[model samples]
Target chain A: MSLDKHAMAELIANDIPRGAYVNLGIGQPTLVADHLPADSGVVLHTENGMLNMGPAATGDQIDPDLMNAGKIPVTELPGSSYFHHADSFAMMRGGHLDVCVLGAFQVSAAGDLANWHTGEPEAIPAVGGAMDLAIGAKSVFVMMTLFAKDGSAKLVEKCSYPLTGVGCVDRVYTDHATFLITPDGVVVRETFGISFDELAARVPVKLLAPAR
Target chain B: MSATICDSAAEAVAGIEDGSTILVGGFGMAGMPVELVDALIEQGAKDLTVVSNNAGNGDTGLAALLAKGRVRKMVCSFPRQSDSWVFDGLYRAGKIELDLVPQGNLAERMRAAGAGIGAFFCPTGAGTSLAEGKEVREIDGRTYVLEYPIRGDVALIGAHVSDRMGNLVYRKTARNFGPVMATAAKLVIAQVSEVVDTGRLDPEAIVTPSIYVDRVVAV
Candidate 1:
């Protein structure tokens, strides 16, 4: 069966290596945090300026001053630390982060990412931490619907919109399939509901089978 | 010399000139110094270029100041948020200009200003629209774009507590830009929840050293 958002998140959660320092991008990519196992030893980093950030705070746990990058009130876990924005970005840019899950508007075959601005004259572009997160993390995993509302593929030969980072994505996790973007080509690691041929047909780019 | 303790927020923000590039600290409304921003609004400085994380949330603080048509430009990371209708309205009407930097660059650029760094190569915006027209270089097999320091004329910040000498400590993530912005500006004005005697604050635990701070007002 085709994966829903939760299934996609669960898949991504299960794949994260143990003790990974992870940053979950805003929106759908954040769902990966919920599916992470309790004893996984993974630490969450929020760009707004906290590490070991806990789940959404409710009731008494909510502190006006403590929030995630999305500006949502959040709880902090034990060993959680606060830092200024410079140090926070330094953690990512210095190659200290292991993995960062991002939501992409489009990811090209060469792994070029375009998720920040759509380039629409009417759209007020906001590029928060996506660019730094893209090139910083050792691995950049993208989460997005495989197709646009107009029924076009999100994975394409080249990104048409304003790019966030160049050749930065490692893997793209979508509802229909999980694809590994490699120097060799776009490899279909696994498909959920559609056949390999159907998936290939839907996407404009050529695809490769898993090397193994 | 230590910072002067102000009796009110308005007194702290006095003498800010028009067309000043002010660094207002906050990520959304968390560490936002609402009182100081209100005072800036009351102080009636116009043609301002503000640098912050977000433009504003709802119709308060920065948004209120923007609504007053005092700000001419916003140099920030993210300006479009769910509650950012005020910035949207003015921006749509061409009333305010925007200079969008990535969040990391927004912080580090100001940090460069504070630390006396001239310019640095960063890999963040390399090969993006933002990097276009900027100088690019290859260092150790990776491409980097040149970025300059972002200094501010005045810094308005928020903190949880401060000592009489203006050694400041902040609560949780509220410390986002306060520490860095404090150093990046000529005059720093901090609005704190409480101010105690100079020796009361543990010097070891102080987030922002008093040397960078110029004025402290207990909000």
Candidate 2:
């Protein structure tokens, strides 16, 4: 069976180093905060001028003022600090973040990311912080499904959708497999519920064998 | 003390005319200046341009302004949240225009305007369609797109408290864009929950100093 969203989050969480300052993009990538180990020492940053953000708040704990870029209520940990919007973006665009996890509409074999818009006329071009996080984070980890709902591969030879950043994604964690993107080529690190050969057959691009 | 207090929200935004560019402070509903926005609507200013993080959360505030067809254009980062139906409907019908900026770039452009910088290069949106029509330069072997500063004709902001002199304090994350918007606008009108004496506010607690504020209306 293909891994669900939570399983995909857990898989992505495995790669986050301790004490890393991370930004969780809207949607599935935000789930990574829930699965992070308590001792991981990860400091969550929100683009709207908050640092040390905790998991999503629920029920009575929800504070309308305490929300992420997605406009969802969230809790704050001790030592949380708020600043002006400019200073917050300075942290993201200035290469201060250790890693940022983002959801992708498409990722290319060469590590290009396209998550902002589908280029549809009806689609609202809400770029948000994706372009900043995609290029600003020291390492960008894209969490998404291997295939779209239409059974088409999201990992492609070239991204058909508008790009958020070029040659920025370092790794991709999908329901079917985890791929490491290096300058040389795409490398399959591991697979779930399928063999390397099966995963290779499903994808459009050539996948290189992992270095032993 | 400076007498920056306005008797009403209408008085605070009285001079805003058609085609004026307004910098609205908030992220979602957190720090929105509802009274000031309502006054702008009641003022019946048409063909206005708004700069904010999001278009609007629901049927009130900025959305109401858009619904009334007061806004001709929106410059924002995220304009497609679930409650942003007004913008979506107008944009689809070609009634309103949209200039989508990356969140960080949006914030930096405002800051650059406030800080008196003409133009600066940013690494965000370097290789994307957003970079189109902008100057591109390679810095330290990396590409950066040049973005100009963004200033506004007026700014409507919300704060927790404001002293008579207009020194403002914000509640938690509600301060999102208020501080920066205050500096970038020609006339800064702040909606505060309460008004206090100048000496009553702690020097360190003030987020936006009185120098940048032009008017204050307690809602």
Candidate 3:
């Protein structure tokens, strides 16, 4: 069976190196924080201006002034520090972040990312920090299903949607399997419930099979 | 020169000319200067350009200002949110112009403006529509797009406390753009929960020095 969102998040959380400064994008990526071990030493970076972000705040702990990038109230950990927007993004674009996990609409064989906009004429576009994380993080990971709701492959040879960053994605974790983007091309790292051949057939890009 | 202690929000926000580019500080409602914005609306500054993180939420604060057709353009990174209906309506109806910039660039541009930088080449938006037609050059073997500063005629900021010197301190994430915006504008106005006597607030703890602030209003 394919991995559920929880399982996928856990897999990503377990792979993170200890003491890695990570920024998990909003939505499904935010759940990765849940599976991180208590002593993982992982520092969470919120684009809205926080570091060492803690779990969700409740009751007396909740402060309107302290929230995650997703605008949800969050607590501050022991090493937490607050800065202004410029300093916050400098941590991103200045090569200070070790990893950033993002959600995507499509990822290309060349590791281009497209998630911010669908290119719809009437749709309101909101890019946020997607492009910064895409280009800045030392290693950029993506967590999303292999296919869209229309049953189309999201791992395409070329992105049909507008791109967030060009040649930026490092690893892609999908329900079917985990794929690693390399200078050569996209390669299968491991399979979940699907076979390498079947995954290759389903994805439009000619994926490099894993070395057994 | 020292910052003047204003008696009211309207007084702090006064003298902002029409069609001015204003920097409104906040990451949503967290650090929004609602009192100053309310005053700006009442002060009737139209054809304005607003730079902030999110456009507006619900029907209060910045949204209310936008609803009155006071904004001519919005220079922001993200404008679409669940309750950003006011900005959405104006954008869809072509009542306002939207300059969608990457969040990092949004901050850096303003930082550049305040720092007196000519312009800087950035890697964040390279090879994307946001960098389209802009000057792209290879620096240190990596592609970079030239981005310019985003200055403001006035900056409206919200902080937790302010002393008579106009030195300010903010609370947690509420400090998002306040300190930076304070420097990037010609005039900086801050609305604080309360005011204190000079030298009462520890100078070392002040996030924004009095040099960058023009007015301090206690709401």
- Candidate number achieving the greatest lDDT relative to the actual structure: 1
Report the lDDT tens digits of candidate 1 across residue range A1-212: 88999999999999999999999999998899999999998999999889999999999998999999888889989989999999999999999999999999899999999999999999998999999999999999999999999999999999999999999999999989899998899999999888999999999999998878
Model 1 lDDT tens row, B65-138: 99999999999989999999999999999999999999999999999999999999999999999999999999
Pairs of colliding residues, candidate 2? none
What would the TM-scores of all predictions be? 0.99, 0.97, 0.99
**Candidate with maximal DockQ:** 1
Error of 1 at A145 (Å): 1.2
Off by over 4 Å in 1: none
The TM-score-based order of candidates, best leading, equals 1, 3, 2
lDDT of 3 by residue, B1-219 (tens): 989999999899888999899999998899999999999999998999999988999999999999999999999888999899999999999998999989889889999999999999999889888888999999988999999999999999999999998999999999998988998999999999999999899878999999999999999
Model 1 residue A98 distance off true place after TM-score fit, in angstroms = 0.5
Candidate 3 lands at a TM-score of 0.99
DockQ of 3: 0.90
Query: DockQ of every model listed?
Result: 0.92, 0.83, 0.90
Place model 3 in a CAPRI quality band.
high
Write one digit per residue (lDDT tens) for candidate 2, span B69-139.
98889999999999898889999899999999998898899999999999998999988999998999998
